[model samples]
Target: MTQNCFDDGDEDDVPEWADRVMADVAREVRRRRKEMKWSAQDLADRCEAIGFPIPRNVIANMESGRRAVLPLVEVMVLAEALYTHPIRLIYPVGYVEEVQQLPLTYPVDTAQAMSWFAGLNEDFRADHRMLRHHVAHRTAVERAFFAVHSEERQRRAAESTVDDIEQAKALRTQADLAERTARAKAELYQVRSDIYADGDPLPDLPDELVDVDPPEGYERDTD
Candidate 1:
């Protein structure tokens, strides 16, 4: 005799592993839905919006353990609606660690990891945007500093006064120090961008100088 949908089969009929996996999926679905404060009907609505129409009753059945077999398409659509990756629904415990361990040199691996990461944490995307902006602004400032200092150096070289020579030396020293500082910062920010914004392009920073804000009461050379 065929077992009904709600029937708990005899111990011999269903393998322990299958039961455990289904239960895990159901629990994960319920947990993520609750995290977003979405009701079963809300989830159904969202799935329908994404072109996979799951009814509210089916959602209730899945969460309540009445539904045992979850289709892959349903899992994918449900994950999309929940703003999470399908792996999170399947392997709630080890998905992040497993994805992190993948070799990122392969383009496919990198793409998959990024997609998973984006779905899991919205804040990561926001942080990446802010970091990119900071790097760009610093790069512009460093370029301006170099251009200004180079013009000043040429002007100082043309002056023959002893006072002018000493002042030129001081200016050169200051410019050298600032360049080193900016280079160090750019390198650090580049390393951070590589790790956190994997698969995204980072702003190209000027090679020569580091970025520095002018000190209070210090007048910028307008020439």
Candidate 2:
């Protein structure tokens, strides 16, 4: 409900209550932007589409305590485009209590918690370095980064186990073949050694020579 103060025909540079209301509205809008992940450009685009014609600088002003409330329809459009209830754009603090009541256990060390908070708004260079370290150290940040891909890793491990087993069987078969080849080679050498006799003399002739028969005719006459 916009009241027409001009009816009194008295001009005040700024109204005290209006100033406080603007401040509260600005803070709520800022908080809602953070919650909805909407950039100034996103809000501007929505306002433009809804015939509000809000410049990005005006959105920034409204979100930084520099401007009063936007028109009601503009707030509604922003809420709809951000996929949130319209009241949230005007009173984002409503969600703070719920966020505080969440079941997550805050870190015990205040310094560690502050460090994590600082990383959220870090400069681009520090952000890159922090992400690199997070991956290199396999910290919680890295785990959360890869949570979506963990199932794929498990599947790959399962397939690799099958290949590993086949490779092990192949190695064992190769070892067995090598052992059999070595034994056959050894037996061949032993047979060759027996034939050569290490340069020893050959065995004597057959003992049949000792009983050589006389002339066939003389043997028959004696009988």
Candidate 3:
């Protein structure tokens, strides 16, 4: 006889806190899936595609709280299918605050950390994107300059002379500067991302948190 995937056999052993968390996770999963206009079957198919293999009925059970045990793997796959981070599903605002005083382990969870970052206020998110754009631009410039520098170095080496050595040295210095600049920009963005994601208090913003278009000629290159 085949056992039910939803029946983990320890349903009665789940704590009230865990039950509440699962309920919240269920609501979030259902909400996000609906927001994406995906049916439960669609979600199940997606989970299966990602190798988690949750059945449609299992998803329904999860969303309806008929299933008490929600594995982390399933939550992750579901979150991916719903185009969100697992933290959103597992650690909604209320849940986080409720568990804040407890010795919960979510604070150290990387996925939760990323979800928190992704859920930061508009201003921080905007600033992060801008910093990311700057980093990308600098990195692209560095790569292009490095390629040219490599070619120049090879050509100069073939000539077997030190005539252009100073110029090559200057180019190398510029490349190093560009790399440092990119690293600094990336570090700044990461710091902000981590701070906001960790729910630390942020200072007042210089401006309102409205969404602004990327600066001219420096559009975000997510790729």
* TM-score for each model: 0.39, 0.32, 0.43
Q: After superposition, which runs of candidate 2 have C-alpha atoms over 4 Å from their true positions?
A: 1-14, 93-223
For candidate 1, give the lDDT of residue 140.
53
Q: After superposition, how far is residue 189 of candidate 1 from its true place, in Å?
A: 27
lDDT of 1 by residue, 13-117 (tens): 344435545666677788889989999999999999999899999989988989868888988898899998887776665422222212212112323555554
- lDDT of each model, Cα atoms only? 0.60, 0.47, 0.59
* Residue 160 C-alpha lDDT in model 3: 61
Error of 2 at 219 (Å): 99
Question: Compared to the true structure, candidate 2 yields what TM-score?
Answer: 0.32
- For model 1, the stretches where C-alpha displacement exceeds 4 angstroms are 1-14, 94-223
Over 163-213, each residue of candidate 2 has an lDDT whose tens digit, in order, gives 777757655655555455445434433332332333322222123221111
**Clashing residue pairs in candidate 2, if any?**
none
lDDT of candidate model 2 versus the reference? 0.47
* TM-score-superior candidate, 2 or 3: 3
Separately for all candidates shown, the number of backbone clashes (residues 3 or more apart, or on different chains) is 2, 0, 0
